[model samples]
Target: MGLRKKVIWITGASSGIGEALAYEFNKKGAHLILSARRTGELERVKENCSNHEESVKILPLDLAEADQMEAKAVEALAMYGHVDMLINNGGVSQRSYAVDTEMSTVRKVMEVNFFGTVGLTKALLPEMIKQKSGHIVVISSVMGKFGTKFRSTYAASKHALHGYFDSLRQELYEHNVNVSLVCPGYVKTDVTINALTGSGEKFNKMGKGQKNAMPPEEFAKKLIPKLAAGKDEIYLGGAELMGVYLKRFVPGLFSKLLKRVRVT
Candidate 1:
């Protein structure tokens, strides 16, 4: 029942939380399939794992390519004959106002963050159902629970994830497949640097909150235990975590306070 020898596929494994998870899981003797659009970086991450030669493999993938995910899912399953868990961590972030954001940028974000994730999950869902055992972990954001400035579209995609996965949890209950939604507040990752602006250009700068965010390694360490405990949904991060509660308990007060938050 522990992570030992469990085959876990982690997308966005080239860096940030995914990379950190790879290392942590590797130490626990889990077999890993690391994935991302950056094959070279994935290889580097593989090399750093505990038993790189036999315990880890890399699969290059672009979550934006929703059309190809079903095929990729087949390929992923073939890597180890079965996958005990799939971590849907590949996604893009946003850094622009709704009015200034172009339709194309909005669509691109949704495509990669929402549709792409769903496509890949659907591709793997049948197998999980057939086996009657599997775990689906989604790396959503605090924005999923509440709206914030400069993250309208990004928030929308994450919100969509919650709705889709919450329903999925109920549907898969009888089948024994588990869905865990991880809502991260702020982590010190390159997400901000690569966030898309209204013009569809990279933001290229880290925000104050991001710079002061939790380290991915620490975040991963704290997360795995909760995940292993079979939590359905978990909120992880720093001071920003209060937003999740305030949004639920004090909707009006939270809305007024959200307006003053400097999300960038």
Candidate 2:
């Protein structure tokens, strides 16, 4: 569908893929609701948009606070009277082994990555169904398709999104609502630097894969058309995307390869 004048609400708009998407969508003449925990960073992103004064609205949100999602959804619907699309892009990453990770840390990751996303979607779903039109886009990861070292909870959270949204897609299909699950391989973003450790502290270091991953802007540029095409499942990245296939068709070989790959 054409994006001109479409009201798109995107979480995690302060940085990374979400930020790039805001700018790209703005370029397509789409109205934007930018959200994240950092109000200042949200404002920075808004100001950087093409028509920030008229087309962009800042809505500071913290996904970890899932309880507030309904209220936030009401506030968002009030902004444009209706939302054409909701991008579930706000999430935290884990950089800890499952055995080393504390239960609290696991809960924190699951809360932010899975529960929070689902809560927000559930809040807005009624409105979309009422309108009989909407697009739900999720920015999942390659880890969603397969597990690796140091990302047990992170991978689980992503896997949960696939299950939840895949089912949601079937239910929403007859209602004219579209659901897109976007599985991104490594992208050059601060996700790694801000990833949670076993103790819940920030990883604070960019991994080799992350440093050399696709640029967020480039990734966004390639993603917009696929989104417009209403693709049910979208995958973007480098060779890492191949793992999704390997795990699907040749689990034995994929499992052997996983042991040797440096996942961080």
Candidate 3:
């Protein structure tokens, strides 16, 4: 996973962490296939990159639409021959009261964040197995380790990612396919503002935790090497990495701490 000439495909590359990652990885000399719904923004990102402009390829599509991912992946493979790593970062977050949240909103978040990720992973896995080398990096959240108030669906989706990818790592070990789960806590991104509300509308703002979040570039700089080192799962956040170990070693106390936490 130490890039070099690795053919890496990153979904959700339009902005935020993904955009910063694209530039950083491009500088590292990885051939990139960038994916998102916004072709214009992809072009803009490509324009903004300081080097390796030709290394970036754009594949625009909605992650929620699982039907299209397999085909699009084929198109990517046709262009790049093979993908050494697939960073499944395309997802949405839902932050709303569980009781008041519409079923549609919950399902939409799962469809994009969990199930669609599954679809793309499954699609690319065969080739990975055949090549006997590939890495699947999932952009999960700190909520994956510990759930919180008003973010039920998003937490569940991220948690589901951990369940699936961790299992995949164990199952695919002999085949040389590695799985890395990235849990970022309150990264400075538009994620909170675009998070879905209970009524299936935009949340239209940021939470207090988000206001003091880590910069995406700094987060990526800290994270990429761990991934390159083949860490199976890693967490990123200012004060939130404590939650991951706390939940594992002291569940009851972690629960009590979470109860008093003012995440919003």
Candidate 4:
């Protein structure tokens, strides 16, 4: 279906890729329900969209507050009728060494990336199933495909998403609800700085490598159409996405290569 009439609900819309997708979809004529913890940033993003004159409702939220999510969905749905798609885009990254990482840090990341996605999707599945058509787009990462240096917990969180969403797709296929996962390498975002560490505080700044990553707006411009056409899984990045396939076929060499990576 065309994006023009779709009522899309996106989490983490305050900044980064989510904000970029907001504008992209708005330009394509989709109704938007933007959710994030920062209302001010959401307002700025809402205003930036080319079709600001259309319905653009902002819902402030912390995805990690998993218990209240269903109610949040209720409130969000009330804004626009039925949600045509729910983008599970809110998540935190882990930046400390796993050995030194506290249980709390790992749990927090899972809470947002894994459990939060689960809760929200679960709450909405029945409605979508009843409607017989819906799309759940998950924003996972290349880290989801393989573990890397300095990102053990982050890797685990993304890995968990692949497991969960893949199974959901299989289970729901007969019902006509589509679940697609997007695996992106790195886009220019404040993710590293906002990432959490062992003590449950921010990593405090962006990584050196992330400073030169692709811009979010450019990434979305390419990603939206593929999603609209029902592509099952998508991987976007320069050469980094190649590593996913390399590891699958020539795993021994891939393992050796990963040793030399100084991931920031």
TM-score of each: 0.98, 0.99, 0.96, 0.97
In terms of TM-score, how similar is model 2 to the real structure? Answer: 0.99
Error of 2 at 8 (Å): 0.4
RMSD of 1: 0.8
Candidate 2 error regions (>4 Å): none
Off by over 4 Å in 3: 50-53
Error of 2 at 245 (Å): 0.6
> Candidate 4: where is the Cα deviation over 4 Å?
51-53
Per-residue lDDT over 99-214 for candidate 2, one digit per residue giving the tens place of the 0 to 100 score: 99999999999999999999999999999999999999999998999999999999999999999999999999999999999999989999999999999999999988888889
All candidates: CA RMSD (Å): 0.8, 0.7, 1.3, 1.2
lDDT of each: 0.93, 0.95, 0.88, 0.89
Query: What ranges in model 1 sit over 4 Å off?
Result: none
Best of the candidates, lDDT: 2
lDDT of 4 by residue, 31-124 (tens): 9999998999999988887667667889898889888788988987788779999999989888888888999888999899899889989988
Better of 2 and 4 by lDDT: 2
Residue lDDT tens for model 3, 118-142: 9999989999999999999999988
Which residue pairs show collisions in model 2?
A: none
Extract clashing residue pairs from model 4: 193-205
